[model samples]
Target: MSAAHVISILSSKKARTMTESSQAMEQWADKLEAVARRQDTQAFEALFNHFAPLIKAFALSSGLQRQGDHLPDELVQDVMLAIWRKAASYDRRKAAASTWIFTIARNQRIDTLRRLSKYQNDISADEIWDLEGDTELFGEIRQSRVQTQVRDQLKELPVDQRQVMAKVFLEDKSHQEVASEMGLPLGTVKSRVRLAMKKLKLSLEALDL
Candidate 1:
């Protein structure tokens, strides 16, 4: 075929893919609406079948798999239960069903992490800092002073970087969790956290001088 014909064929394929994706989303929305309106078990079952595996994978990718084999399964169950309970609140005009479901999964994952972290009694000042390197300067100061200095430096960071840093260090979210929540790539989230840490280190060192 001619080059123009190949380009035309590719464009048609792309259009078909977009159309198929939209149709799938619409079907999911319809199922969710059915559950909301009637408490339809079959509709909910369909949604569960479709989204459960996806939720499990999302939890695993966020490092929950390493936490325990059962945690990912528990997270998936929690997300699906939230969907069933909150189905009445779903607004298709505001978000697609998949978006709403995955958002619940992300939030559920964060909450799970927080609950797990609470059991750890050994978290030190350095662990709270969460920075990659050991800055001797931070070790010399009281944790309270370090916290104040870090908070001040955090304010000076660019908003994008600062938000990622807050999620990772303050909220105790994994980088993958932040990436999923913020709809950014994993590498992008990690880079933002690294950049934020470097800035924090320099600012704190200057304050110590």
Candidate 2:
């Protein structure tokens, strides 16, 4: 075949692929909308059949398998439940059905991690700020002074680091929870928290407290 003819064939294939993709997206959206508009179990079942395997793969890739073989199943259940309950909130214009559903899966994974971490040796705010060293000195006067100093130091941190520190320490959220809520990768959230803590530690040391 001539090069131009071959190029035309490739272009036709690409267009067909795009059209098929758009149709598939629209079909998913229609199914989800049916479930939303009415308690359509069949439509919901269709969604489940389409999304469950994909979600399972995502869960395994996200390290859920390390926790337990059953955890991925649990995550899938949670994501589907959220879809059922929150179907009415979905807007196709804002996100495709797959995008919306996977976001829920991601958040559910974070929540699962938070639940699992609770049973582990989770760090406390006092530990993060090194207040465990001097029990006597951590009394009311010293506690108040340290709190004021820490607040001041927190204000000096970069915005991203400060937000992560606030969510993880002040709000008592797990790193995974902070990551999901902030729309950041888990690693980025952890790195920000670590950087924030390091800065706080340096500031506290300079204060000799």
Candidate 3:
């Protein structure tokens, strides 16, 4: 064959390969959208089978593992559940299907971590009343204001400190436990918890004033 003809043939073959790849990707995206719009179990199962191992690897690499080999599986389940619930909200224009699913998985991991941090910190109602410093005695309205202020202040806290606070108070974890789980020094964990508490208290105290 002439060199010119051979080059043209190779170029045509490359074009066909590219086209096939593009079509395959489009079909995958369409399947994801179908699951979102119709809650199609088969479509979801296909996606889960394809992406679960990848998501699990991501979770493990990111240090989200449980002691047993269950964290990756659990994390995949959580991601899939979020995808199921939020399928209708998916917007193809804003993000590709794979990108959207990955984002959901990432957010679920963060939520799982925060949930672990908030599992069991016990505080009594009497202590709460004292913390509000007779504000409730003034009126229900005053108590509501204090509650709102506390929530707002908590939201305003830096993410690192907030995580520490959640683990220490809500999860009922000791600072050592928080340190161990987070892979930080015990003093660092204590410092974060103390700083978070101080900032929250100051914000609430200012609101009370």
Candidate 4:
């Protein structure tokens, strides 16, 4: 085996179980896994088709577009490229492809948000781990498992509120900083943060997170 194939064989224990993958995805997944394990193009195409929409929806929902619901297809396109680039390291045992894809889009959305602002930063698993004060519980849940639950929770939030949360946590900008920077009133910023947290808490509960 080449160095890459060697690595995949060594790490298979931590990846998702291909044996349990859905019937719809199993045959293709097996082929893709083989191609991916060997560092070939076949795996890449399969991932792009299975995960692109999920990534796009995540980016849009995480506040990629504030002007309106309309998002640039190019943004999704770029993110899909990123997905293709990163797909090789994915461990199926850890997270389903969908959860992993959603997280990628979520992170991409945050990256775009940071670019819009004047922050210099370079970047989590459990939703609770992200929320602060729950590191232990966060650790118990698998990253992939949490992503599966968290992505749906995120989908239910209002667009405006989700943007505020993303800006605060993802961008590491304070509410005051965001308010001053975005030129929104301080009261509005506080209100939005509070609302985002409340909704997030509820979502977490719903997900059994």
Candidate 5:
């Protein structure tokens, strides 16, 4: 076969493959829109059947699965549930259906892992502190140590961030309450809190050393 003829054939095949992928993606987006607009059960089932294996493979490959673990069924369910809840928020103009759905899955997985880590941290803290110890003394010592660390870290933060952390944590105010009181955007308040949490986690970890 001539090299030119082979090159043309390969180009045609590549174009056909791209067109097929595009069509499949459009169908998926159409089904997602149907679910959003009409609560179409069939459309959802179609999505579930098509994407379940793909999501499971992604979870396994991404380290969400462990030794002897076949698939992250719970993670997949959580992602699907999130998709159902947030379907109305999907924008085709912004991203394709596969990208949108998988982004939801990725976010859901991250949130799940964070919650699990927090739960494990809580358990570890409980195990370390004698629950049976003098409850009052334990509380007092724990509160004192935490307050000292927080105060030290607060000094390290930027002035604006420090203020937000103080109002939210030290004052026992909700993020929304602090935002309203400070006249800052709620997002700014939340961002400061998240930054504070990261720094506090690091400082607290160092204290353990």
Candidate 6:
């Protein structure tokens, strides 16, 4: 095909390929990338555990709980699917994975809440993908451009700071929770998290979306 013809065909496809792939095994990463683009069942599950709570917290915080009829899980799943379907447009540079994921959750939650009063009846109990709750470790198979950037920025920080961050941030523990678990002083845990955030914020200063 002509380059222009190939480009046009790609433009019409539902899933977009990565702009840059790192290595040969990285072709495997392309599979999940395609899954994300296609929003396959597997990819959705992998993503859900990672970002579900963030969405749930966002929804509950936004007052979705007042809806007697809407299950928080339902709302979160809806938001997550929307994210999956829209994955093609994801700009990883502009937002952290959680931030982008939660933004979708937030928007979906808003949509669900919008119909709160209107949904006066019970919806079917289908097995909605628990996008926000399941914590499957779809190990970092291969780094995409975005994941690579994140890894590099993370590498720039001290090892101890990184350890604290992995616990408190990625592990979803609070400063106190991490502190108690690690047997560190509460203040020390808080300081570590604060410092971690400062480092990340600085490293990511160029992009804030």
Q: What is the C-alpha RMSD of each candidate to the true structure, in Å?
A: 16.0, 18.0, 17.3, 13.8, 21.3, 14.5
lDDT against true structure, model 3: 0.68
Give residue 45's lDDT in candidate 1 (0 to 100): 95
Better of 5 and 6 by TM-score: 5
Model 1 C-alpha lDDT per residue in residues 1-209, reported as the tens digit of each score = 99999999999986786567667878999999999999999999999898999888777766787878899899888889988888897766556566567667666776677777756444443234322223344342343344345645767899999878867854447899889999999999988888887877634345665
Candidate order, lDDT descending:
1, 2, 5, 3, 4, 6
For this target, which candidate reaches the highest TM-score against the unseen true structure? 1
lDDT of 6: 0.57
Q: List clashing residue pairs in candidate 6.
A: 48-131, 49-134, 52-132
Worst 10 residues of 6 by lDDT: 125-134
Residue lDDT tens for model 3, 1-209? 99999999999986786566556555667877888778789988888888888778767755666544777789889888877787776654444456567667666665656556646445423233222233223253443344345555887899999878767754436789889999999999988877886776644345656
- CA lDDT of each prediction against the hidden true structure: 0.74, 0.72, 0.68, 0.59, 0.68, 0.57
Error of 6 at 143 (Å): 18
Distance from true location, Cα of 117 in model 5, Å: 1.1
Identify the superior model by lDDT, candidate 2 or candidate 5: 2
Q: Indicate which candidate wins on lDDT.
A: 1
Q: Judging by lDDT, tell me the better candidate of 1 and 3.
A: 1
Q: Distance (Å) between predicted and true CA of 90, model 2?
A: 0.5
Off by over 4 Å in 5: 1-3, 62-71, 119-209
Assess candidate 5 and give its TM-score to the true structure: 0.51
Clashing pairs in 5: none
Clashing residue pairs in candidate 3 are 121-170
Clashing pairs in 1: none
lDDT, residue 159, candidate 5: 81
Residue 139 in candidate 3 has what lDDT? Answer: 51
